[model samples]
Target chain A: GAGVSQSPRYKVAKRGQDVALRCDPISGHVSLFWYQQALGQGPEFLTYFQNEAQLDKSGLPSDRFFAERPEGSVSTLKIQRTQQEDSAVYLCASSPDRVVPISGNTIYFGEGSWLTVV
Target chain B: SQQGEEDPQALSIQEGENATMNCSYKTSINNLQWYRQNSGRGLVHLILIRSNEREKHSGRLRVTLDTSKKSSSLLITASRAADTASYFCATYFSGSARQLTFGSGTQLTVLP
Candidate 1:
């Protein structure tokens, strides 16, 4: 793919329903990240992946929030028993390497999946 | 929690004028990055300045980082109507898990 791709650009779920969002990062990118952005706010960190290893999950808001990057190329963020407070835009980003690049360091972002919990 | 805080929450400027946005952070950071968003969708990376580097330039965008003050500024020269969007400042900590903490952002409106 030319850039980071995300699935289900928009999703509306019931209060107790479970929803899953997917992300496809750039080819061979070593780092993947997930973030949640509320209305009129900047994106907040959710989780990070270094290849297939899940290095950080501290940013996950609750036990219902889970993310996985199985093959290191594609990732999924699942929310169980969605709440109205969970309504937000879920963003996925990718970087070329583990260490920040001094010359051309930049992270690519997906269009994001907007989730609405009714 | 967000580490960066941006000033001038909303900016309205005429096209061809310059726009400046400021950001401040609490902790030591490896680098600071600027990003732009249109229609509240994906973010586009604008420029990045390392902690050791004082200033950097990319096209019409100029970024300055002052580690001593723990603050940074982004300047857009000769802004156009197309430049009307939200701009954000993100900080990357050296020891943290590759997470980029972002500020609330500044909404810039370049009127034609």
Candidate 2:
């Protein structure tokens, strides 16, 4: 089965520009998550979606960050007025279900979209 | 805030030797998961240990969880040069969504 996949493997954007990153979760996956990882740092949660509903956006660093999953399978993370600090690798992960324990639900990750804000 | 914290930011070991990494979390969790990432790419899930389980094993990977101490340890026995990578411990909090809070990770270098 195909694992999670992200588009635009690399993106270079000038400061104050807007960029949108896309994610395609595995077929039938019910849970999707977005994370931001700085160089040599662990991934930080950005947002979560179950089906087509966005459940948690608390991890989003600022209001400029927004995400949506309208069709329940594909998601997009949009950054408005990107800043130099936004330079990092954006990771996407998906799991079968959220109710199941972590041991039972193995979250698959994508190669990630690397964003460079110059 | 990040829930998990891994000690010993970096480690260097000879091939065929064992490597141990530890993680500590501030809050209670239902399970602890270990993941490996190579070259800062996607993370690969290694093992998961439930709060009730003291130890679990998968191939060369061994994970142990101690709820009383809010800490966990991942041990790799007979590590090979290919095992060199960044290892992370993620905590799944109880009652919350299954989202994982990952630690900074420990970079391991296995020299052949």
Interface Cα root-mean-square deviation for all models: 2.3, 1.8
Model 1, position A50, has a per-residue lDDT of 91
Q: What's the residue-level lDDT of A40 in candidate 1?
A: 84
Candidate 1 structure quality by residue, lDDT tens digits, B1-112 = 8888899999999999999999999988888999999975799999888888999999999999999999999999999999999999998875574678999999999999
Off by over 4 Å in 2: A101-104
Per-candidate DockQ values are 0.60, 0.66
**Window of ten residues with lowest summed lDDT in model 1 chain A:** A97-106
DockQ of 2: 0.66
Residue A98's lDDT within candidate 1 is 79
Candidate 2, residues A15-50, lDDT tens digits: the string is: 999999999999999999999999999999899899
Candidate 2 lDDT for residue B43: 95
lDDT of 1 by residue, A8-64 (tens): 999999999999999999999999999999988889999999999999899999999
RMSD of each: 1.4, 1.3
lDDT of 2: 0.91
Name the regions of candidate 1 deviating beyond 4 angstroms. Answer: A101-104
